[model samples]
Target: MEDENNLAVLICGAGAAGLTLAIDLARRGVPFRLIEKMDSPFPGSRGKGMQPRTQEVFEDLGIIDRVVAAGGTYPRMREYQSDGTHTEKDIAERDDPTPAEPYHIALMIPQFLTEELMRERLAELGHRVEFGYELVGFEQDEQSVTSRLIGPAGEEFVQSRYLIGADGGRSFVRGALGVNFPGKTLGVRAMVADAALTGLDREVWHQFNNGNMERMLSICPLAGTDLFQIQAVIPLEGEVDLSDEGIMGMIRERCARHDVKVQSVTWASAYSMNARLADRYRIGRVLLVGDAAHIHPPTGGQGLNTSVQDAYNLGWKLAAVLGGAPDHLLDSYESERRPVAEAMLGLAAGLLDAAKRGEMRRGRELRQLDIGYTESPLTLNRPGRWGPLLAGDRAPDAPLRGAAGSFRRLFDLFTGSHWTLVGFEAERNITSGRKGLHIHRVGPGCELQDMAGHFRNAYGLTPGEWVLVRPDGYVAAMVTPDETSILQMFFSEVGLTDADGLRH
Candidate 1:
């Protein structure tokens, strides 16, 4: 609630996407306010598994350790038959190397914990969510966007330079902008639950079919609380009461060795899955991110991850342009992220189809592909099919040593609100501090080093390799031994011009 004339990015919905967007912008020193229609938190665990890419995003947001500490590593993601037959080969290795701190396995954590951790980060940045303030409508000019907000007291109008509809699938903002979320809906509804159980079989995730019924089961180990989240999928079409007893019995019948008693239940719910994608994610001064932009079946557990990553892709550019970097800088938000969304939609459809056909092996393996931005203007010298030359989506999380402390990490330098010029084992120089770039020298003698961390080789550097990391944690530019496009592309493409355009 600052000056009405002074507006930044006004976001709708404070869920995973909305909050992550808020936190990213805040960390970028951008002013933004997030609003949610509901006044209270959604009870029960929502999204469960955290993808590898998402865990990397959390690391950039400085919350991965918290999430990892809260979420015990499953070490393996398995797909099994109802009769307990392993289908897909277990995936345990990180693929597609990136300079980004963690090119590791996907971490599974409760969506609630992810949301809470993001909110805590936002709090640390002095931005609080305006809960219950629903977005009724919004109108945008070239310079600013006016949003109508409704809450308990009544109606309030908010104005911002840009408006992001991070709201759920039924996005009012998308509708206001006349975007079409065209896709097919599943006739087969799935019942998902997060309940306590005394299980007969122990596995991280179990997926298979019993006769005509197909189901997916996941046992995510949550930290702090000895409680575990028992997620089971029940096919729709039958008159099944979604009560605690019914869910427990379904799980018992599915897993128990007969005559097994049901233990206490924690939470349960049922919902149908739909695969949909917005025709366009950007229009004028308004844009869509997260579920507002696209949605798909929860098979890969990618809904939250996709949206949060969308924000990560957007947050910095929007913050930069709004904070007076360049207006065209914001346009790249669409150019870079939209295609990624399309790819995700395509991948999700494939997974859903595999699940529908009981092709669990195909689904898991396809989902395991950590395909980064292979096709986008953001990637450097990227051949249409291969991927970005300097790891477009994946940033190198090299073992960086800093002067502060032994625990310092690579993202630590970029997380703050400035473009970082990191010259490994070399001195860095800025023309002047007023130019809005931060330079830090990282060397072996520096104190920061992972004691037990796994990213020793991926980002573990030796003597001399120069890289320029953007505030968003993507490699803005890099100069490796063999590859060399460090100076010109970065300075010319990503760096700002005096004319106020993102010089690509």
Candidate 2:
């Protein structure tokens, strides 16, 4: 039996990224310890936007219903001019959900509430975060990572196969590893607060600005709650007060409306925007994820969403390695995610510039549905066999009909921690009774029937074609009936075989 105290992974930080990885590992039966330095959960309403891709991840994690119930769509932007004139416009162009993309709009829920929901789900999986445990330092070897923790009970030493730093931008783990985070601070300070206020409409996002970044103020209603999130840009030089009275004063001066009053401020903070990415993602057995690996401005609402996806991409790979896969499999996490972080950093910086110019135009890119791994080492694409979707692209969802005439969807089949091989009108039986692999056939007389032709239309598939999807919902490989051997070869390259299964 495995030692209960010895963990497969030791995760530091209890933010969305850390909690996400913990939940994934817990459901997979991977032993892990999630620790947070703070004594309690975060109380701020920062990072409140959930992109479409993140919504899809929430569905697989089994919290989509609750998340959707607790969230609301981005409201119309109500801008207040200096002459007391106001205009209303949509914050982002809304898209309806189709048969292919089930979630087409961004959902708005405060960060604290999202974390609370995830914590509840983690408890259901028989695990809970270890709060007030601070990771002071650690060292790694070829076999294991030994970490030192400072908690209420004093100091303790623990060992795990790997250590992941989901800690924020000033990450202690990254500093200990001496990683270089090269970027510039934008030299603009912004104050953000969550408070209960009177006299402000709750249906739209209220903005008071004079076409200057340093003179912008926004009060937006927080969905599923009785409060508003207030944000204001402070001057570059000088100290800005964060008290309730100071915040109210700033709001009154900017909007020229004394009727709006802040009753109370629950949480507040002042922060300077910066864009940075770690030069490397891993060193030996210690790795970085989320804000520890990259930090950027909050202009595009991509910070939290991107961090959550980072953890999602790394969770399965870490579990695979701990279950006796090659260590090189862990290397692919950085190779795949680092470039994405870099690209998103550039995008967020560009959006910040746009926001300063009062041109906050949000498009499909902000939804993050187009991110993929077409250039990863793990992806395999057969030459001259490309369709609308290719290897390393996100697998689109489609409606299906079950053998018993029950309604089904592709996401329902890809919900668990298993590899899915979907054969579309294939001749031979590709069903493998492997422990961690699931095979489904979609055709006229198969177990799953695409009677509406949604699958064929979404995947652009002809007869005798098969698509293998990875655990994280990306197309791993595409093959024809004659190229069935490619599936076995692909599995072998990823360190999985039929004899050993995916995990021992």
For residues 180-244, write the lDDT of model 1, one tens digit per residue.
Answer: 99887766577655555554344444433422445444555444344556555565666666676
The lDDT of model 1 is: 0.65
Report the C-alpha displacement of residue 153, candidate 2, in angstroms.
0.7
Residue-pair clash count for candidate 1? 10
Q: What lDDT does the true structure give each of the candidates?
A: 0.65, 0.88
lDDT of 2 by residue, 1-504 (tens): 235376789999999999999989988899889999999999999999999999999999999889889878888999988877899998888878998899999999999999999999999999898899999999889999999999989998889999999999999999999999999998778889999999998999999883588679999999978989998888877788878899889987788788999899999988999999999999999999999999989888999999999999999888877776778988989989998999999999888888888997889988888889998988878878656898888999999999998999999999988888888987666545655778899987789999789899888888888888888899888878777666776675564557446422
Provide TM-scores for the models.
0.80, 0.97
- Candidate 1: worst 10 consecutive residues by lDDT? 380-389
Clashes of 2: 0
- Residue 189 of model 2 has an lDDT of 83
Who wins the TM-score comparison? Answer: 2
